[model samples]
Target: MTPTVIIQLFVFLLAGFVGFQTITRIPPLLHTPLMAATNAISGISLVASLVLAGSNQGLFSTILGTIAVGCATANVVGGFLITDRMLAMFKPAKLEAKESVA
Candidate 1:
């Protein structure tokens, strides 16, 4: 493989390892805040993918960017949804019911 490809592969593997380690080390109590942060990051990625998809670079790039946008959008939405659910778990039943009934 080309040097660039090899370097990229190495970086990808390293990032994956680091991300796994970092996530595993976080306390469960902190996950709700982290999920909000992750959702924000995913939202940023969705915006980036939208830009790429419309960049007019090439057919393949546009297609790949479109897929990325879809995946990132899903991630952002799902993350926020899960975060909201987790936050609700901490609310008193009265407050939860009031909000739900509104």
Candidate 2:
């Protein structure tokens, strides 16, 4: 593999390890906030992916970018849904019931 690919792979592996450790060490109480922040970051990625998908790049790049867009969209939407549900758990029961009916 090229030097660039090797470096990228090393960085990716390091990030995976560090992210796993950091996330696992967080208290359960903090997961909601973490999800919210990641969702915002994923929204930024979605924008970047859209630019890639729309560009007059090569066929392979366009295909890869389109796939990235779909994955990013799912990640952003799913994270928000999970975060909202987690936040809802902290609300008063009365408010929760009222919103459920609306």
Candidate 3:
């Protein structure tokens, strides 16, 4: 295989490993707040992308910026919503246990 392809595969595997660890280790309470912060960062990326898109940039650069913005926005919004839902899952169980123990 080509060197570039090998590097890409390595990166892909590394990303998958880290992603798995993140999802497994992150607590529900922390997930919502972390996702909110990620959303803010992505919002900034989207604004920067818009500004770059208006410039006399190369086609490839513009396209890359657009894709980056789209991916970041999706991650931000979807991640936050998913995190909120995950947190909700813990709440009902905790509430029931609390009531039973009291």
Q: Which candidate is the best by TM-score?
A: 2
Worst 10 residues of 3 by lDDT: 83-92
What do the candidate models score in CA lDDT, each in turn? Answer: 0.94, 0.94, 0.79
Residue-wise lDDT of candidate 3 within 1-102, one digit each (tens)?
A: 999999999999999999899888998558677777777877887788777766658898888777877876787788778777766677767686886899
In model 3, the Cα lDDT at residue 82 comes to 79
Residues 1-102 of candidate 1: C-alpha lDDT, one tens digit per residue? 999999999999999999999999999999998998888889899999999999999999999999999999899889988998898889998997897899
Cand. 1 Cα-lDDT: 0.94
Model 3 misplacement above 4 A: 74-102
Error of 3 at 89 (Å): 9.5
- Model 2 global lDDT (CA atoms, 0 to 1): 0.94
Q: What is the lDDT of residue 14 in candidate 1?
A: 100
lDDT of 2 by residue, 1-102 (tens): 999999999999999999999999999988888888899999999999999998968999899999999999999999988888899889999997998899
For candidate 1, the 10 contiguous residues with the lowest summed lDDT are 91-100
TM-score per candidate, chains pooled: 0.86, 0.88, 0.54
